[model samples]
Target: MKEKLFRWVVKHRKPIIAFYAVAALVCLFLRQFVGVNYDITSYLPDEAASTVALNTMGDEFEGDIPNCRVMVPNVSIAQALKYKDKIKKVDGVEEVLWLDDAADIDQPLATQDKDTVETYYKKNNALFTVTVNSEKEIEATDAIRDIVGDEGAITGSAMSNALATTSTEQQISIITVAVIAIIFVILVITTTSWAEPILVLLGLGVSVFINWGTNLIFGEISFVTNSAGSILQVAIALDFSVFLLHRFNEERGRHGSVAEDMVQSCCLSSVAVFSSGCTVCIGFIALAAMQFKIGPDLGLALAKGIAISLVSVFTFVPSMFVQFDGFVQKSQHRPFVPPLGKFARLVLKVCIPAAVVILAVVYPARVASTSSDITYYYGTSHIFGSDTRLGQDMDKVKEVFGNSDTYVVLVPRGEVSEEQALSNELKALPEVKSIQSYVDVASPYIPTGMAEKDTLDLVEGEHHSRLVLTVTAPYEGPSTFKLVKKIRCIADKHYPGKAMLAGEGVSTTDLKDTITVDKGKVDLIAVVAVFAVLLLATKSLSLPIILVLVIETSIWINFAAPLYTGMHEFFLAYLIVSSIQLGVAVDYGILIADRYREDRVTMHKREALLETMEACTIPVLTSGSVLLISGFLIHAISSHGVLKQIGWFLGVGVSISLVAVLFALPGFLYVLDGLIGKTTLKAHFLPKDAQDPVSDTTEASAADGSAQ
Candidate 1:
């Protein structure tokens, strides 16, 4: 099958190259038709209580939860009422609720109930819960800004999401350009030909468009997927093209014709690249096992990207190389990396002590990776530039309101007495600062017809009553988890199976719980999956363990570096970086190991190790530097903290992996070659004076081919 693919690629190079070029352009155009969804609640599993309650609230209340909160400082009761009226008049605003919505604003504040007034009016500030039409939130928000002017501040999920969409659209192109420039610089310095890097990037760049165009099948993707997916696809896929081109260059010198050289190189490099790509695919696919849909969304897109990249390298890259054969030959120069036999020995000498020191710090790294101060995890600061008016508005809102969690509870419509009792219980809890229920506005003793219809419907649905509980417990802390558990207990005791809880806090709590377990499962699955691939690729029992250990150690060091800085790391970053770094770094080991296996047949063990390092270091280091630069660029340029942290971890991981692969891997292989020989399915390594059986068999086959 490999030989056939090679033959066909060489035979039909022109058409294949032209088809991919056109297909890439078509995909680029088609991708603009695809949509992106930034609503986090919408991504939750249907069976989750928060998801169900959110859906039910939207159904019963004529819209979803309050999408934006408008803060009006130093406003009179009359002025606040007038502001609410104007907001309601906005085209896409479905509803606006403030102190006046529940009480008569003309009445003295002293006469009104304290709970109702305090809910909307705190100190000299008044707040409005604005429910905007989902499809027109941006337009509605713009209208609100126009009416409120600079004094009024608005912050909420919808506003943040709108900002994120704009921010991502603005920055993705910049990120692409930066990554390409950095990659080009690295390739130019390391490779013999200047055109090689550009050609490789062309294949990867086209593959990114094709991968994104296919997302149209899914209808939409998350904000994270939209932002990070294309860049990551390019970074990972570039390796295959680089590997193939390097092999082709080497083989071209040995073969009589360019076509024959490409065919032989493609057949050998395909098996290598296919195995490595599969390992990465398996690592990404493990993310789908997470119950959290965010993992699955990112995982599926990246996994598909890896598949596209593999196909592109096998088809698109070879065809382009064939077309540019003469130019490529003309463009060749001496590689920048001179032979480093002494450097390889120096690396081996320091390898053991360095490994031992890294092992000592692994525990500290694990602890730092796990510890996070999560109160600010979902802040709106990242939505807009801090220097902008919109950013200032968000800061003002946060300052005035402080960070508080709101939980919406639903229970079967029971005797008004039971609801009144439940509301009292919730209000009495230490963490609960306030509770708004139907009982707040009207007493159960009064007839339903006598109560204001709008006031009655505000907290009462057809079959269920709603209670909005404001809690002081910080998110993702033990207090928050305990508060949630206590509320669930109270609900279960009061209403049995009819009670459900949903809110930002509830959703985040669920996220925390899911990822705590998900981290371990994702790591284990990534290692085992990649291990299986290595085992098949090497046909050696000992090689897989050595390779995995080398990469995992680098990952731990990457994670540990964050502990020195007091900034809290996002929990998802650890799980994702661990799996991804392992998947990515293993390719380096595979490349070196493959070279070592070939070199050992002709050279002594230590001499073979040096030759392997000298041969493999440039490509391995170039790939690492590209990853490192890309990661740091993301860290430096992104407004969102999670993305920045992810980028930092990625950069650190690649740096450490490069060091390990170049230094420790060779040292370990030098010591363990005899054991590797004993366990291998196809042992090829021999001492300096030993005869080679595999080479003899290959020579005999070539002689037979010549005779035929």
Candidate 2:
């Protein structure tokens, strides 16, 4: 079946190339329909208390989240009120809540509680909560900016997401170009042919487009997925093409023509590439099982991308190679990277001691990785610096508000007495800076009927009453999470089974809990799935265990370095890097181990090991370096701290994996060869011979000639 398929592909090479070109165009056209969602809160599970509260509040009170906040410094209540009225007239504005919205501005200021009044109207500044549909936030924010002019500040989730989306959209083309250029240069240096690098990129570049275009099927993807997915697809696509090219070149010496060599190489290369691709897909597929919607959003996209790249490599890349046969051969040169025989020998000598040191320190690294800072998840760090309007607005609000945390508490309405009691208890808490509620604005002493209907409706909904609790603590500290719990306790005491908390503090707490549960599941699924693939491919229990250990050690070392430096990593990044590194980097071990097994059938253990390293190291290094550089370049170029952190860790992880695959795996295999040969099903290895060098040197020289 494999021979027939390869023969058919070779016979229809031109048509196959044309077919992919058309498919790529169709995918490109579909790209416009791929929507992007920037809201992190949307990633939360629907059953979460915060999510329930938000939906209920939206339905019952028509009080959508005040995702955009406007801060006007040194402005009087009268002027701020006028400004609010003007903002309300904007096209997308739904509701504008200010001090006057809660109480009649016509009434005397002396009648209101000082803290309640100051919450919105301080001595020299006023804050307005402008509620707009998330879809129209950019329009509404632009209109608000025009109204507020240079003095006022605008900062919130709505604006930050809008800014991030806009910034990423503007920079993606440049980043993609930069990545392609970098990979092209690396391929040129490592590969023997200049034309091979271009063909390699062309083949992979089309695959990236197909992956992106197919996102139309998903409707919308998370902001992070769209940002990172393209680069990853490009890198992986290039790796697959490189694998095919290397195999094709090896077959050239024995075959009569380029077309014949490619046809013969297709089946073997497809098996290897497909197996490795499955491991990568498994790694990402585990993410789709996460309760967090972002996991599925990113996981499905990446997994699909890898699948598409694999198909394109098998079908599209081979066609291109045959079409450009003459140019590829004419452009051949000595590979810039030389053999690593001496380095491999030195690394093998220290393998046992290095493995011991790694075992000793891995636990500390695991423990340290668990200590992550959740604060960065809530705030926005602008990529364009503070000189931009978004950055300046963020700074202005932070300066006026200091570091404060706010919570939106929803409780059953119509229990005026219990509600008043809950409000009083919240006010008395040392952590609570202030509280804005119906009881605070319109006292219980005043009959509900006598109060203005509009004013009453603002705080008291049909089924739920809203209390905006301002706390002195910042969003990330222990004090802030503690304060959130304290407020929940008070709500349960006063209105048990009816109260729910929804805000940054509540959302962050949910994220921490949700991710904690999902992390274990993802890890287990990835390990089991990849293990099964390796077991099936190699038919050896011992081989899978040894390979997994080598790759996992690299992951431990990658995360451990951050802990050693006392750097605070984003919690989600730690989980993501762990599974991805294990799945993707394990391929290097598979490549070497597979070759070693093949060579061992004819040669002794030491000779086979040396020959395998000589053949596999450059290809592994080329692919690994591409992956590493792509990540670090993102770190160096992107301004967002979240993206930068993710890039830095991925780059570091891939680099560590390369070291383990090249140095540590060979050492382990050498020492464990006897056990492996005995346990591995259908294993065959030649007897040890003192004259193994003759065959090794001859094979190495022939391999060198072919590369040049």
Candidate 3:
């Protein structure tokens, strides 16, 4: 069956090539009409908890709910009040709630007994909360700059349509330029011909379009994020191109004719390439199981992108390679020995000791340094810097507001009949800085002529009530978790069976706690799943164990380095480390294992190991170097601490995995050969009579005669 399929592909190569060319062109043209969306919210399903909460809040609230908050420094209360009217007039703004104004009511307002309104007002900085109805209403952030008008520094909790658009555009631009530059560098290094990487990148460009076009057929989901998806696609697509070229070179070294070599190379490499692609695609597929909407959306996008890359590699790559066959054949080789020989030797000398040191130092260090704080992943620069608006405003707000950390208390109207009583009890809690509720706003001091009242007449009946409390400390670190627990305890004591916390800050804190508790479980599941696949692929229990050790070592080293760097967001780091270790590192193990088995059929065990390392080293190094460099370049465009940490860790991990595969795996294999006592390594299940009979000797003699 395999022989028939191979013969059929060879016979119909021209038509197959033409079909893919047309498909690529059509996809490219269709892409001109498509646009990519990067909104994080887009990843959530319409009914997901976060999305549902946002929608529910949007419906219940009379005014717009601010998504982006701004704080202006060095502004007087009077000066800030003057801009309120101007800010209200800004396009897309639904309402601007200023501290200086209160709407009149027909009924008397209730008064607070705990703290006088005057005292409360004096303690809190006067703030203007501007809210916009939609991003589409205001296309650019210039509208915001216009409203502020260079006046006394203006800042407040405000969502602007303009800012979102600008940020998205900036992110896209950065990713595009970075991907192009990295591809250029990779092309220069791998092919040494200026045109080769260019062609490969061109193929990648086509693949992106194909991915986009096919996604439309699948129903327009959220556009893949430029930062994660676009960059990842380029890196992954290049891997396929690298595999194709590497195999082409291998075939040309044995077969005399470029045309015949192309067919053989495609047949041999396609199996490994497709398998590697499946592993990557499956790594992403695991994201589908994530409860978060973004996780599944990312999974789908990556899965699609991997599929497109596989198709393009099989079709678009082969066409380009065939076109450049003569040029590829003419490229000179210096025949310098691969470093894997020395690396294998070094591994023999140091494998056990290095493994011992890694286990003793790196594993414990990683465990000790793991933290639950998500903000650390965002980095100190992004958290405190004034470059981005969020950073700038967060700094001002933190200073003026004391701490921007907030908590929410939800009360059931069944038990809590009097709003004042609930507010009073919550205020007495040590963690509560200030409370904002309809009941507090309706207090007599807010409307001096009104009398004090215990009940809110306007909002009556069994509706759920909410209290917005500002916490004393910043909403980061271990203390926040403790505060959340304490708040829950306070709620249980006072408003038993009637209250729950529901707000961005509270929900986020809960998520952090949940992730922390489930970290080990999730990691264990992912690792086991990946290991099962590796065992099936290699069909050797010892090999899978060796691969897992290499991967775990890489993950530990990758994670441990962040502790020294002062980067402590363990969850994101763990996700990234695990994914890369499983996806990219596994490819290296497969390459070496496949080569070792192939050589075992003809050579002595030691010679087979050495020759396998020699045959596979260049391709492994080429692919690994490209991935490492591209990942490292992610930091150049992103000041976001999480991205930088990921870039650094992933880059380092890929490089380290390359080293382990070249040294540790070979060393382990040699040790295994010694133990197994002359047992033959099993070759991959290939069809009989499908092997290429061409030899290096025959090709070399033909090349020498041609030169003469």
Candidate 4:
């Protein structure tokens, strides 16, 4: 069956090439339909406090939690009121609150309360808490910016999301070009034929483009998925092509014709290709199980991209290689890379010592990794540097307003007396800077009957009354999370199960809780799935255990590094890197072990180990270098917080994984060859008849404590 398929593929090489060409055009055209969602808060589970509160607010009230705040500095009361009205009139601006709503702006400035007045208008600046529809954020913010030109500064959750989406999308375009250029240079230095690199890129690039087009099925993906998915596809796609090229070139002279060699290569490469790809897919597929929607969003996209790249490599790559045979053949140069035989010997000599050192430190690394300081907030304020406009605007607001956020507490409208009592209790709390409700404002200043219809409507909904609490806490952190819990406790005490809270603090708490559950679940799922794949491929019960152990050690150290450095990693990055590094980086170990297994059939242990290292070293180093550089490059180039953390983790992870696979795995294999030989199916760990000759140097080294 395999022979027939390969024969047909080569026979119809031109037609196969033409099919991908047309598919590429169709995929490119389909790219416009894939939408991007930027709001991380929207990914919260339905049962979370913020999500429930948000839903109830949507049904019961015309307004939502404030998402944007625009400050027009140096404006008179009348001018500020005029500016507020203009902003309110803008399309998509649902509700705008200025000083007039809280304290009568018409009153004399001397008689009006100073703290109340200064909350909205202070230091000749008027700050407006604008509730804008998330879908219309860009349109509304742009129009509001037009209203308050040079003197206005805008920052809030809405504006932060808009900036995050726009900037990340832009950075992806720039980084894709840089990544491609660097990958091409790496391939050139490693590959004997220059055209092979071009073919590999074209083959893989088309797959990534098609992966984007395929996202139309998802309707919309998170901006995080769209930002990171394509680059990862490009990087991982090379793994499949690298193994195929190696198999093809290695089998070139033994076969009668190029087509025969290509077919033989495909057959020989199948186990490695599927094993590696399956492990990577398992890693991504585990993410789809996360309670956080971004997990599914990113997981499905990345898993799909990996599957598509695998198919493209096996089918499209073979066709391209055959069709462009003369071009690829003539472009061949001497491979600039060489097998470091001396280095392999040295690594083998210290294998036992290095393994001992790794074992001694790995436990400490695992403990520290679990204790890493993780931040859950996705706000661009924390992500972007203070020099950025978003960060500056946030700092400016905190400096003036004393670092506060507004949470809308919803409860059944019982009576003005009860509501007022609830409001007063809430206002008395140290965290509660102020409170705004119909009971708080209407009774003291304007009678309910005399209040303007719009102002009254903002506070009173059909089934619920809204108390907007101004709390002295930043957007998200331990303090804000604690504040949210305390406020929820108070609201529940007054109106249990009837009251709901909506704000960034509540949302961040939900995000933190949701991801905390997924971290363990994802780890378990990935390990089990990848272990099954490794077990089936190697047909050895013990091989999978050893490989997972070595790779997992690398992961422990990767996450633990953040603790030593005092960098509070984004919480999602740990789960992401753990799965990615375990599944993806384990391929290096797989290659080494598989080669060692094959070579042991004909040669003694040390001879086979040397040959395996020499054959496996170039591809592993090339692919590992590509992945590591791309990781650090993304970390360096991307301004997005999540991407930066993910990039840094990936860079560090791949480097550690490389060291383990190259140095540590060989040691384990040498020491445990008897176990592997006894356990692996068909038993290829030793030469036939159990007596293979070793070189004098290798024999002398073995006598010095190589075998137990």
Candidate 5:
């Protein structure tokens, strides 16, 4: 069936080319409508306490959980109130809370509770919490910034997400251009023909654009998905075209026409490319199964991309090569990087030692990889690395007022005395900066006519009264999560099942809980799925073990680096890298193993490995190196901490994969060749004599029958 499809591709080269051309153009046009989601909170499950509380609050009340905080220096009570009013009037500002809202600012502020007053006003600086709609984050933040001018700093979800959106868009644009040029240059530097680089990139590029264009169907993707997916698709799937094209060139001398050569080339290279693509897809399938929605968000994008790239390689690549045969022939040049068949001699000397070393470190590397310091939260300050306005503002806010986090508790409106008891207990905690509840700030149990409007409006609600706790939780971490847990306990202790908690602290804590579970599950699923695919692809039990070990060891080595360096890895990057690196890096092992399986039909295990290295090294390393260079390039240019770490880890990850695949994999295959052959069915190469270059014979069948 696949052979027939390859023939169809060859016969209808022009139509295939035309379809891709038109599809690429159409997808590009549609790609613009695909939205990018910057809110990490949106990825949280609906059942999370924060999610439920948030949903309930949105439905029941006009007020929202504060999304931003603005601090202005050298402001008096009246001036601060004026600033509050101005911020409140901003188009997107639904609510802005300052000291005036809770206290009678018309009187001397010193008469009010010290902690309560100081939480909002300290060192002649006034801080205000601004609630803005998620959709208008950027516009609203911009308006808020304008109102504050140069003397103020704003930090919170609104501004953080705004920066996340804008910065990711800009960074992605720059990264795509830079990485493409880098890949092209590397391809040209290594390939035997100048046009080979162009054709390869063009095939991969069109697939990438088409993948992005197709994102319209999903409506939106996370910022990380769009940021990482496009480039990764190119890097991971690059070898498909290279392997097919090289095979095409090899077959060209025998065939009468370019179409015939391409058809045969597709036949020979199909299983290799398909196997590699399948393993990569398996990795993504595991990621898509993650409890965290962002896993599926990115997983589906990447999986779809690899699928599209596989199709492009089999169809568009063959068609374009045939169409541009004359140009390829015209531009053909001597290879700058000679075939690395000689490197097999060097690898033979070290393969044992390398494998031994890797085996010895396997347990430690695995342990270290799991033990590396990781952060679950990505605040704007952290993502921006304290290098931009958003980051700097966040730092300034933290410096001036310390890490003030707010938690909103909603309870039955009539339970004012219980709320007061809860508020008093919360106030007794040293870290609690202030508490604004109806019992403290308003005349509890009074008729509507007796209560002050501003104070009553701030805490009172029609169905559920709001209690705002300003605490020194320091944004998000183990300590903040601990505080959140303690606070939830306190709320429940006082109000029983009725008290609900919602805020950044709660959300971040929930994120921590959800991802902690997801991380291990994602890894397990990816390994098992990829291992299953390998077992089927190679048809050898031992070979699957060897290939998966090489791939996973390289990943372990990559992830374990941060532990040695004392660099805190982002938890998201950890999950993303685990899935992506496993999915993509396993290709190296599969490519080598697949080619080895093919070559062993007529050759001994040692000779098969040498030949395998000779044939597979360039494409394998070319693919891995492309990813390495791209990862490092992104690391260098990306300002986001997680993105930078991802790039670095992936770059280092591929570097490890290159060495392991090129050197250690040969060792493993040679050492375990007997087990491979014994566990396998009598192997027969696919394709006719035209596709099978080894020239089959009774000797070939005898050699194939042995454990390779």
Candidate 6:
């Protein structure tokens, strides 16, 4: 069956070549219409618990959705009141609520005692809350910026959207350009012909379009699906093309006819490429097992994309290959010689003593270092910009609001009827900065002698119930946690089954809590899925374990570097670490193992290892170098530190995986060969050659005549 398929490809090469040329042109034009989505909310599952809760809250809030807080500095109560109408007149602004308006008019500042008046109304500074009705229709970021204009600064969770989107787009663009450039350079170096790289790129472009067109046919394309998988496709397709072309050249060098050599090349290279693609597809499919919404989507998209790339390699790549085979053969390119191969040989020569030294020194150093901080995921500029925004906003909020901290407590609807008890308990909490409830708002102007409980009559109505307590902490760190916990305890004691906490701080805490709870399950799923793919691909129990070890080591080393660099962040670590490890490590493992298996058939275990190293090293190193250049280029373009961190970690991880494959895999293979029976190991490494039960001299004569 394989021989027949090979013969067909050879016989119809010209027609196939023409078909591919037409297809490539069609695909090229179709790709321009594809759009990319950058919304973070897109990553969330439609039915996820947090998403559900958020949606429920949104529905309840109705027309009163919360807007991002805005702060202005060096402004007084009078000044704020004076500009209140001006602020309200802003195009997007609905209404501005300030402390001056919130305060009771009956107890005017001049009537209150000095200390009481001072506490109630500061002379110079005032805080205001702006409510925009279009919160749901318009992005909070766009609305906030429109209102604030150039007059004042705004900061909060809303700002994160703009910053994150801009940074992510920039990172993607920079990485894509850099990766392409690096791949082009590497191709030129290896093939020694500028035209070959251009041809490979042309093939890649066609593959990308086909991949897109297929996805479009399926339905709406996912942004993550498109961006993340496109690069992976390009990398895999280019490598496959290089492999096929190289094999074609080798067959020709053996004095075989062009048609025969082309058939042989396709048969040999396609098997390896298809096998590798299957493994990658399995690895990605395994991600579907993850509980997170984005995880499954990422897995499915990547798996599909890889499968498409393999098909493209067989069809589109072959067609292009047939057209360009003559030029490629004439190029006389030198194979890549990895710089690290020589270093590996040097280490092997002094293995015993060097191993002892590494164990003694490096092992201890590894213990002292820890996994990288999540902040490092953002890279440098992102962190600095975020910090600047936080600091500037905090300073302004402090000046205007008299306190930078705020908290919101939710009392159950039933518990709100017992508002007096809840308010008293909430106000008594040690961390309470200030307390406000419907009770404060309902009471008419009261004299100074009025009892405190009587002042709470404002919220006594049955339909309108509940108190909101705002707390200010002495310090930013542990105090916020302590305050929140104390308030929760108070709510539990007074409202027992009903009250809960919900606000900016509470929401942030909830997100963190959810991640912590789900982290282990997600991690386990990812690890198992990746390992299973590796196991099936190598068809060896030990190789899968070694691959996992190499991946883990790369991740650890990549993450730890961020800690030393002091750019680590929790969000960055959670998002990028596993993704980077999964993306680059699997590719490296497949390429190395494929080469090893191909070499094992013709040589002894030791010689096979050496030859595999020589054959695979160039592609592996070139791929790694391209990945690194792309990552660094992203880091350079991104002002966001998290992106820089991702770039750095991903680049480093790829480089380390490359090194591990070259050195660690060979060493481990050597040990495995020593332990496993030589015959089994050799058989495992050998490629599956086509079986020829029948020979036809007539066909051979025709093939030779056609070649001439």
Query: Which candidate comes out best when scored by lDDT?
Result: 4
Model 1 steric clash pairs:
none
> Between candidates 5 and 6, which one is better according to TM-score?
5
Clashing pairs in 5: 677-707
TM per candidate:
0.92, 0.91, 0.80, 0.94, 0.94, 0.76
lDDT of 2 by residue, 1-708 (tens): 887877778879899999889888999999889899877778898998788888888787765756677888887777887888998898888888777755566877779766556667766788877777889877888888888888888877777777777777666667778888888888888888889989988888788778879898899998888898888777765667777787787788677877778888887676567778888888888999998888888888988998998887777888888888888878888878776788667766776676666667667666655545323243233333476677788777777765555578888877789889898899899767677678877777777778777767777888888897766555454666677788888899988788988876677777767877998898889889999998888778788998888787778778766555766566566666676688667677777887788778887787788778877877787888888888888777665556667789889998888877887788777888888888778887766654455587888999999999
Candidate 6 to native Cα RMSD, angstroms: 8.0
Estimate the TM-score for candidate 2. 0.91
lDDT scores for all predictions?
0.77, 0.78, 0.58, 0.83, 0.82, 0.55
Ranking of candidates on lDDT, top first: 4, 5, 2, 1, 3, 6
| Runs with alpha carbons beyond 4 Å of true place in candidate 1 | 102-104, 111-116, 358-395, 473-478, 688-708
Off by over 4 Å in 2: 102-114, 339-353, 371-395, 443-451, 689-708
Tens digits of per-residue lDDT for model 4, 1-708: 877888888888888889888888899899998888988888887887789889988997888898888898888988998999999999999989878878876679779877667778888889998998988888888898799885688888888877787788888788888889988998899889989889989998889888888899999998878887888878876888888888788998698988888888888778788789888988999999998888888888899999998888778999999888889999989968776788778877987777776788789888888873633444434776676677777777777776767799998874677678788889778888667898876664456678768767888888888999777777778888798888888888888778888997778878888888988899889999999999999999989998988888889989888777878678767777787788777778888888888888877788888888877887888788888888898888888778888899989999999888888889888888888999999965565466665565667787887665
Candidate 3: where are CA atoms >4 Å away? 1-7, 10-18, 21-55, 72-78, 101-125, 134-142, 149-165, 192-195, 216-224, 253-259, 323-389, 405-418, 443-462, 470-475, 489-500, 674-708
Across 2-94, the per-residue lDDT of candidate 1 in tens digits comes to: 778788988898998888888888888889888887766566667777778877876665544566778888988778888889999999998
Model 6 scores worst on lDDT over the 10 consecutive residues at 372-381
lDDT of 6 by residue, 1-708 (tens): 776776776677678767766776776677667554433333444544335434544444322223345654456556666656666666555545555433544566666443323333454544445555432323544655555555566544345445555555666776677778888878787665556787778777776766666564434444445544666567645656777665665576453567676677788776556655665566566556544444566567666767766776666666666667677668656655334456546434543443243234344334433442323121111243534554466555555444433454545443434666767666666556455565454432343235354334322223333344445542223455566567767777876755556444444444444445455555566667667766655666666675666666655565555456675454533444455456456666666666666666555555556656666666666666766666666556655554555456556667766666666656656556533333233344432253221123446778999999
5 versus 6: better lDDT goes to: 5
Q: Model 4, which residues run further than 4 Å from truth?
A: 109-114, 146-151, 372-381, 444-451, 687-708
Clashing pairs in 2: none
